[model samples]
Target: MKKTVKLTVNGTTYERDVEPRTLLVHFLRDELGLTGTHIGCDTSQCGACTVSVNGQSLKSCTAFAVQLQGAEVMTIEGLAKEGELHPIQQGFWEMHGLQCGYCTPGMIMQSVQLLDRNPNPTEEEIRRGIEGNLCRCTGYQNIVKSIQWAAQHKNQGQTEIPEASAPKVDPQPIAPVP
Candidate 1:
C-alpha cells in the first residue's frame, strides 16, 4: 500500500506518498533526490546511510519512511549553510578524513551527533563514537583526527579555522574478526 508521509528535511517540508516498505534512505534518495546518503549495508551494519531524525543519528536504511511521519530529518546535504561548512565537514576536508568518499556523508552525520553528546571526546571515545560507521578507504586515523579537530573548534563562531595536523604516524590496520 502507498502511504502518505509528511516530514521536514534540511529545513524543507516535504509531503509525499511512499510505499509502506520504503526505507528512509530510499525515500531521501529516490523520492526527494537527496543522494548524499549512501546505502552501504542495507542491514544497518554499516552507518553509511545514517541521518539525523529528530536530532538523533540513526541508520536510515533500517527506518521506514512511514515511521518518520511528522519528523525532522537532516541529511549530509543540510550540514552546511550559506556556503560555510559545518565544523565537522570542515574537519573532514582539512584532516583528509575521507578517500573514495563513499562513507563521508554518514561519518560526518554520526560525528555531529557524537560531538553534540560529548564535545570533548578522547581518541578512544571518538573511536567508540564512530564505531558504527565504516570507512574502507583512508583508515580511521584521519577520521579520528577530523573529529578531534571539530571538537577543538566547537562553539567558536566566526573564528578562523586552524589547519588540522596529526603529528603521529598512522596506525596499522585492524584485522577483521572471523
Candidate 2:
C-alpha cells in the first residue's frame, strides 16, 4: 500500500504517495526528481546519500520516507540561494574538492553540520567531521581545503562561479593503412 508522506524539502512543502519500504534517497531521486543526492552504498557506509533532516545530517538510505512524515529535509539542491552558491559549495568549486563529483553532495551536506557545530574546526577536526563520508578521488586533501575555505568565508557572500565550457572533440575516422 502506498502511504502519503508530507514533508518540506528545500523550503518547499511536498506531499506524495510512497511505498512503506521506499528509502528517502529513492523517494528524493525517483519520486521528487532530486538526483543530486547520490546512492553509493545502500549499507549506510558510503554516506553518499546524506541529507539534512530537521537540522541534522542524516543518511537518507537509512530511513524510510514514511518515517519522516513531517520532517524538514534539505538536499544539495538547497545549498544555493538567489543563484549564488553556498559557502561550502563555493569552497568546493574554488578549492577543487571533487574529482568524480559523486561524493560531493553528501560531503557538502555533512560539512554543513560540521561547520554549524564548529565554525572554526581544526584540520584534524575537519578530518574527523567528514570521516563518515568516503571519497575515492582527490585523496581528501582538496576536500579538506574546500571545507576550510568555507570556514574562512562563511560570512561572506559568494557570487556564482560560471560553469567552465568543455572543449569540443570531434571523432574522425582513421585513414586506411595500405
Candidate 3:
C-alpha cells in the first residue's frame, strides 16, 4: 500500500504518494529530484545520505518516507538562498573541505547541525561531531577546518579564508588552493 506524505523541503512544500517501504533518501532523490543527498553506503554507516529532519541531521537511508509526514526537511539544495551560498557551503569551498565531493553534502548538513548546537565547537568537538560522516578523498583536516570556518564566520557577516593546517595523515596530502 502507498502512503501519502507531506514534506517541507528547502522551504517548499511537496505532497506525494509513496510506498511505505521507500527510504527517505530515495524519496528525496528519486521522487523530489534532490540529488545532492547522496547514497554512499545505503546502510547508514557511511553517513553520506544525511539530511536534516526537523533540524536534526540523520541518515535518510534508514528513515521511511512515511515516517516524515509533515516534517520539515533540509537537504544540500536547501542550504543556499537566492543564489548565494550558505556559510557552511562557502566554508567548504574556501576551506577545501571536499575532494571527489561524494560525501560533501552530508558533511555540510551534519556540520550545520553541529554549529547550530555549538557555534564555537573546539577542534576535538568538531572531530567528534563529524565522526559519523566519512570522506575518502580529502583527509579530515580540511573538513574540520571547513566546519571551523563556518563556525567562526557564521554570524560575522564577513568572509575570510583561513590558513589550513597540515594534514595529519601521511604519504598523500590533498593540498588546498592558495
Candidate 4:
C-alpha cells in the first residue's frame, strides 16, 4: 500500500505518496527534486547522505520516508537565507576544502547541525563531529580550516558574504594555530 507523506524541506512543504520501503534520501533527491542531498553509500557508513531532521544530523539512507512524517527536514539547500551562504559552506570554499565536491553538501549539512548545537567548535570537536562525512580531497587540511573559518565568521559576522545562499571563503583565511 502507498502512503502519503508530508515533508517540510528547505522551508518548503512537499506531499507525496510513496512506498514504505522508500529511502528518505531517494525521496528527497528523486521525488522532491532536492538534488543537493547526495547519497555516497547506502549502508549508512558514509555520512554523505546526511540531513537534519528536526535539527538532528542523521544518515538519510538508513531512514525511511514514512518515518519522517511531520518532520522538518533541513538539507544543504536550506542552510542559507536570502542569498546568504551558510558559514559552513563559506568555510569549505574559502579554505579550499573541496576537491571533487562529492561530499560537500553532506559536510555543509552536518556543519549546520554542529553549529546549531555548538556555534563555535574547536578543531578536535569539528573533526569528531564531521567524522562520518568522508572527503578524499585536499587531505582534509582545507576542510578543517574551512570549518574553523566558518566558526569564526558565524560568531563575528564580519566576513564578507559573496553568496548569501552558501557562504564562500574569504580569500581562504589561514588562522594562526595557538
Candidate 5:
C-alpha cells in the first residue's frame, strides 16, 4: 500500500504517494529528482545522504519518506538562491574542498547545520562538527578550510562569484580503473 506524503523541500511543497518503506533518500533522488542527496551507506554510517529536516541535519537513508509528514526538508540544491551560491557552497568551491565530488553535497549539507549552530566555529570545532561525514578523497584539511571560510563569510548572505573569477570545471566521465 502507498501512503500519501506531503512535505516542503527547498521552499517547494510536494505531495506524492509513495511506498511506506521508501527511504527519504530514495524519495528525494528517485521520486523528487533531487539527486544531490547521495546514498553512500545504507546503514547511516557514511552520512552521504544527509539533508536538513525541519532545521535538523538528518541522514535521509535512515528515515522513511512517510515518517516526514509535513516536514520542511532542505537538500543541497536548496542552499543556493537567485543564481548565487550559499557561503558553504562558495567555500567548497574556493577552498578546493572536493576532489571526486561524490561526498561534496552531503558534506555541504552537514556543514550548513554546523554553521547554523555555531557561526564562528573554531578549527577543532569544525573538525568535530563534520566528523560524521566521511570523505575518502581529501583528508579533510580543505574541507575544514571550506567550513572556516563559510563561517567567516556567512553573514554576507548569498555570495556571487564572478564567472571569470570562478574556477572552470570540465566534467568528464570517469573511466573505471582496472
Candidate 6:
C-alpha cells in the first residue's frame, strides 16, 4: 500500500505518496534527488548514509520514509547557505579532510550533528563521535582536524560582530561600467 507522507527537508517541505517500506535514504536520494547521502554498506555498519533527523544523527538507509512524517531532516545539501559554504565544509577543504571524497558528505553531516551537541568536543570526543563513520582514506587525522576547526569556528560565533559582514555585491544589478 502507498502511504502519503510529508517531508520537511533542508528548510523546504514536500508531500508525496510513498511505500511504507521505502527507506529514508531512498526517499532522499531517489525521490528528492539528494545523492549526497550514500549507501556504502547495506548492513548499516558504515555511516556513509548518515543524516540529521530532528537534530539527531541517524542512518538514513535504515530509516523508513513513512517514519519521518513530520520530522525536520537536515542533509549535506542543507548545510551551506546561498553560495557560501558551511564552516565545516570550509574546514574540510582547508584542512584537507578528504581523500577519496566518497565518505565526505556523511562525514560532514555527522560532524555538524556532533558539534551541535558538544560544540567543544575534545580529541577523544571527536574520535568517538566519528567512530561509526569509516573513511578508507586520510586515516582520520585530517578529519579530526576539520572537526576541531569547526568547533572553534562555531565557538567564535558567540562574540558580537562589529559590522556584521564584509562588503559584497548586492542582489540588485549594479550600474554598468563605462
For model 5, the local distance difference test gives: 0.89
Separate clash counts for every candidate: 0, 0, 0, 10, 0, 0
**Residues 71-171, candidate 3, lDDT per residue (tens digit)?**
99999999987787888998888777888999999999999899999989998899899989989987787888888878878868654434463233335
Q: Candidate 4, overall lDDT?
A: 0.84
Superposition error at 41 for model 2 (Å): 1.3
- Give the runs in model 2 whose Cα sits over 4 Å from its true position: 156-178
TM-score for every candidate vs. truth? 0.89, 0.87, 0.88, 0.87, 0.88, 0.87
Over 4 Å off, model 4? 162-178
Residue-level lDDT of model 5, residues 37-147, one tens digit each, is: 999978888899999999999999999999999999999999888888888999898878999998899999999999999988988889899988999998887888788
RMSD of each: 3.4, 9.5, 5.0, 4.2, 6.4, 11.2
Q: Please identify which of the two predictions, 3 or 6, would achieve the higher lDDT against the true structure.
A: 3
Predicted candidate 2 versus true structure: per-residue lDDT over 1-178, tens digit per residue: 9999999999999999999999999999999999999999889998999999999999999999999999999999999988888989888877788999999999999999999999999988999999999999878877887898888778444454445511222255433322
lDDT of each: 0.89, 0.89, 0.87, 0.84, 0.89, 0.85
Distance from true location, Cα of 168 in model 3, Å: 18
lDDT of 5 at 116: 93
Predicted structure 6: clash tally: 0
Question: How much lDDT does candidate 3 score?
Answer: 0.87
